[model samples]
Target: MIRRLIFAFISIAISITIASSIKAAETIRPNVLFIAMDDLNDWIGCMGGHPQTITPNLDRLAKSGVLFTNAHCAAPACNPSRISVFSGIAPNVSGVYANNQVLREVLPDVELLPKSFSKNGYRSTGSGKMLHYIIDAQSWDDYFPEPASEMPIPHTLYPDKRPVSLPRAGPWQYVETDWGALETTDQEFGGDFTVSQWVSEQLAQKHDNPFFLACGIYRPHEPWFVPAKYFEPFPLESILIPPGYKEDDLADLPPEGQRQGPNRYFAHIQKQGQWKHAIQSYLASIHFADAMLGRVLDALDNSEYADNTIVVLWSDHGWHLGEKQHWQKYTAWRVCTRIPLMIRVPKNCPGLPEGTSSGICNQPVNLVSLAPTLFDLCGLPPSKVHDGPSLTPLLKDVDGQWPHVSVTCLHNPGDYGLSDNRWRYIHYANGDEELYDIAADRYEWNNLAADPKYADKLAELRAKGPTSFASKPEPSIQSLNKLTWVTLGDDKAPPSRPDGSQFPVFFINQSEAPVKLYWVDRMGQPKFYEEIQPTKTARQATRPGAIWQITNLQDKPLGYFKVDDRSAQAIIPAH
Candidate 1:
């Protein structure tokens, strides 16, 4: 009887210990809501970019949290830029060289930010352009209601009528009047409504587990679409043009460095005949994005998860408005690379004091820090492969020392890199170089590359860049008339075929001659055998691999490729 009594007492003690452990886990882990905007610059009301550009929702968010003023992107383009943030690796290290590369190919084993939360027992979900082209379905437990949109209709329905070509002049480009109205919306003629509505529903639903929700807004991107109401606020007459450019601004720069293309920023502004209209459109889109943000924030405030959730709002990269004669990203200029980053931690956390007002962190931070920071904020283990340190310390104290700098890579893959908070350096594949003191010349009006005194500083930065994986291996020409290739110039191929097999094939062809071909996999990489010659078939293999097979081919690609055989596909040119 004594033994039985002792066993009962031991079992009761074990139960109590187990319960305490579970409670500890629940209390330590905080939920997260990550909000990412597309092509947004430091134009918010809090940032003081413009007087009429009202971002009340984001302004209030800044009041409640910490803002990073000098944040920049690893790559200014969409695919590589977003991949760097999600993978916590720089574009060079990840091998995501450009917009055409698939992130799964570059960092196949790396656990994404959302995937980390899902693994830690949180209900991970996302909507809209959170992960570039499509939100990796595997990263989230729930991908539904479909990604949110800023327009009412599909993007494919709207096409720019202008001839397709690179622009020649700096900071000018033409935009069609109908370009902004091609998409459909939920309410107020914008698609942000759908994302807001979806987030509201998730907030209302009672869940037993903590949640990680990522909301991505597509507005303020190209085509600058918004409702008529938003346009009303920024009339053409009231819109202020950015500082004017001088003819000799970039005179000392090389011909290669000078702007080249008909559709470049200067051409757009000149052809449009109204630079103010273009600026107005961009501002209107920003305002609409802000309003949508307000809806999501309101939902969070009223929801049961309010006090427990951590909010992070960031942009993929900044946009240029006639600065340095550039309209889009892909440059290292402050107008093109610097983005708006805000973080709102719940009051329960031991970071900043409650209701913090307009705190600005001047340290240079990059999107690469987002993955590790999110993990740290949620009390998760730091990712072993991340290149960025968590900004949690800086958030608590605005004046904290975050001595690190950000780097952005432009054309020529690894060539033409820029390090933040210092001079901008551009190195060509041909060994030519250009340098600028960003602090002294915000507009990049002067070139200091030829200055012998600064040559050592330029060399130091060049030494720090990634040399091993600078460029991927070019694709191989195959016999089966099929081509094998890799994106971002890498030789690595996808692990599995479309049919879930180990074998895969890639194909590419000249645009002048159209031909159909069958590809086969051999020794992991695609080896092509001629299935049909160019004489008979009208359809041509536009790219060397399956992944490239799906991308729109008329535009320039980063030379990555893959193969798909689940179904026979045709490569058609854009009309």
Candidate 2:
């Protein structure tokens, strides 16, 4: 009896130890919900970027967590900014200055953000336009659609008569600058709505692994095509001009800032008398994006993992609407580089009981620190490659004196803006400079760099820029077949393929630069093949359904090549 009692006690102790270990592991492995937005600046309701913007969802989200009002992206373009966020490498070192360069082509073996989470046993899944393109499959465990497509929504919803490509009133803006409501249901509008729905379903369902759920909302970008009902909230007359606009803002600007400004796009909009209408479209798209955010937030609220998930929301870059007389996001101004960044750590989380506040963090931070911050939060091994400082300290204390200043770039060769808490100093490649003290000159109307009083501050900020930039590598072209055009919604290709297949389609990239090829297979589906080096002949068995799309990395079409039964190797014109 004594021996049996001793055995029973040992068994009980072992079971208790096992249960405790399991509970501890579960508590430490918190899930992450990463929300990404495209071309969305501080125009949300909370940031007061626009006077009449409606963004209750984003506002509520900020209240639920810590909001960083002074965050900036490393680069002002989508591709480079996002790459910097994921890779923890700045654009100056990576040399991915443009949207055309493939991330894999630029940094072959760099550790991506999602891959880091995945390494720590987190299941990373995403939907919609997370990256500039949908080609990096190994980074995420699963995507909404296949690995190659941007989103699951088909590319047939664009209005047939939309004057997007209509003879431009001026040569200032591209065809993508036009905007109007599609007059369709949210489901019919597709893209972001579908992406949100899929993400919501995933959140509600149970997963075997701790998840990193990413939802990318692509709107308020360009070709702002939300439903007409969204437009109803913001009538053209109700739309207000940008609040910080100054008529002569560019007068005191440096030559670089001057050249980037006064773009003909805003001038063209005024010339065509569509300034208010364009603003209305932008507001409507922002509202629609907020609705999508609401859907995801609601799903999370009702989800079982609500108490354990860390939610983070950010935009890739900001947009310009007559601010500095600019329209796109290629410039280095605050209107282009300043992005919305918010973080909500769950209650009873490890190292943080009830976590940090729903308060504002005013310290200047860069999006490049996102990866390193996430690693620290999850207790994962930190990376040594990140250039930006982690905000873990500021999250705990909102008013902590942060010594970091954000570095934002425009193009190559050190054309950048170094923004601290009180000042924004811009340096051009041609040795021109522009400085704005944000505390005194909130609108950046006055340039203070040339003033001798601020010379010490000017020299301090100028010393922070990268001493050298990595030279751009070999150029590659993007393919331009129906598959590629489908993602872009380019209506250049015909609705159907030509008759008579059973021919050989020969491809030769005439230019010295490498190119990409996109083609329809025997199964009649769109597929992408990227970074095909130049001087190689790829032959396709041309049947009745065979079609090809070919283009360089810079989006210059090499030529139009087709195959038919009458020819063995057909090379079409490069029109």
Candidate 3:
């Protein structure tokens, strides 16, 4: 009788200890490790999209968390997709439907994703292509290598013959097309690899509170240039035309669907016989991106906070490799809309069961859902409104019965696609429609909109799309007045005009806020040359030893620097 009593007491004590540990975990806020890959498609090894796709890091990450196989971007292009993900606002509502549209002007009131974390006492730091080439000054506590650009590298492999010196193709929008191997090491290429190293260094350090650390990788996007070592694995002979490529996929009924317009990128590759070489380059870039990911993941796993950090890796949107006769992501097809998304919740997180550390989710979900989902997982106060549903349910149960559907657009609301588990419905701006049973036709080879039997089903999915599209917002006049620059640095700086030529001056806005520069004209009077906005530069004729004042939009003096003979030929810090 005494032995039984003693055993019962020990059991009760163990229960009490577990309860106390759970209570303690509830009070501990977790850190966030967010990673983003640029222009990546579902060609990773985990997705099983391509046989030769080698992405061991991405595949391992998928196994470590719930990999959402059917995830889609809120928008297809870079600016809109990124804006939708960060701002928690859909392109239809914000009217930020295209690139070159400044996000601050479109959705000025929305609190960005990182800012919400900062509001809740978390330190947010990020590096490289995180914000689609523009940094949100109010969001981050600090950023590495400030003044972010689209590409981190100063030059590509072939800098001289940009846009490919080859003949015309696909409106030749930007000279972004073309690829080759560089005779250099990964350290020598040093764009995304540097970003990974910086992020890794942060993970190694200790922080006072929770953190939101972001690492952005820009590769495999275009000009697919990586070290020659990455190219060796994918031999030129083994490189085959993408499996999705069809001989004449664009022979369809709808005007919008048949609208190949000016895109000869596919034709250009075929004519130049560089299709296999291009494929090899893309695969090499993907491998390089995967290698960089390995570095970041290694740092996180070896960090002091390894057990308390939530890791998430996502791509902005997928690219097309001659799929449906499309080149880059601007379509509503399954290939263009789908992206790889993985989230690994830490064991120390409160209320989470931590059952099955790795699971796969196949339900269609929107990337815009990320903003609200992070807020939910971090135990922060929810936003006033998020355009999409949260993925908390799917996170808890990979096969959870989620009624939500995914929607994505190209450049406008009407030009969008609505996708669910079994169907893909596209409604273009010109009143053309296309429907496909995704389960039957994975390649989207046939359009089913003409079938009368599926009309009722089409109507149901169409109702889930945007109700009414908002008008595209116009650029502010201040935004339109772009600044022009001239160079002025010290010492080695060119001699200030002894021959009556004005000094070549650089006038870039070095502040987070917009400012105007004023200098004494030839008449010895202070006059406004131009209002230099943030990230904009303007140059004006000024005499040597002339003083220039930079003031905020409200005309408050921020700082002043002089352009003299010694400083004239030198870069001036105009903060």
Which model scores highest in lDDT?
2
Rank the candidate models, highest TM-score first: 2, 3, 1
Tell me the spans in candidate 2 whose CA falls farther than 4 Å from its real position.
1-26, 150-156, 164-172, 348-354, 478-575
Model 2, position 147, has a per-residue lDDT of: 67
* Candidate 2 lDDT over residue span 497-525, tens digit each: 54532544455544566776666454544
Report the lDDT tens digits of candidate 1 across residue range 302-351: 99888878889999888767665666677656666778889877644423
Error of 3 at 446 (Å): 0.9
If the candidates were sorted by their lDDT against the true structure, best first, what order would they fall in?
2, 3, 1
Model 1's lDDT to the true fold?
A: 0.65
Error of 1 at 324 (Å): 2.1
Cα RMSD (angstroms) for every candidate in the order listed: 11.1, 9.8, 10.4
Give the higher-lDDT candidate: 1 or 2: 2
* Cα lDDT, model 3, residue 521: 46
Q: In model 3, which range of ten residues has the least summed lDDT? A: 491-500
Q: For each candidate, give its TM-score against the true structure.
A: 0.73, 0.82, 0.78
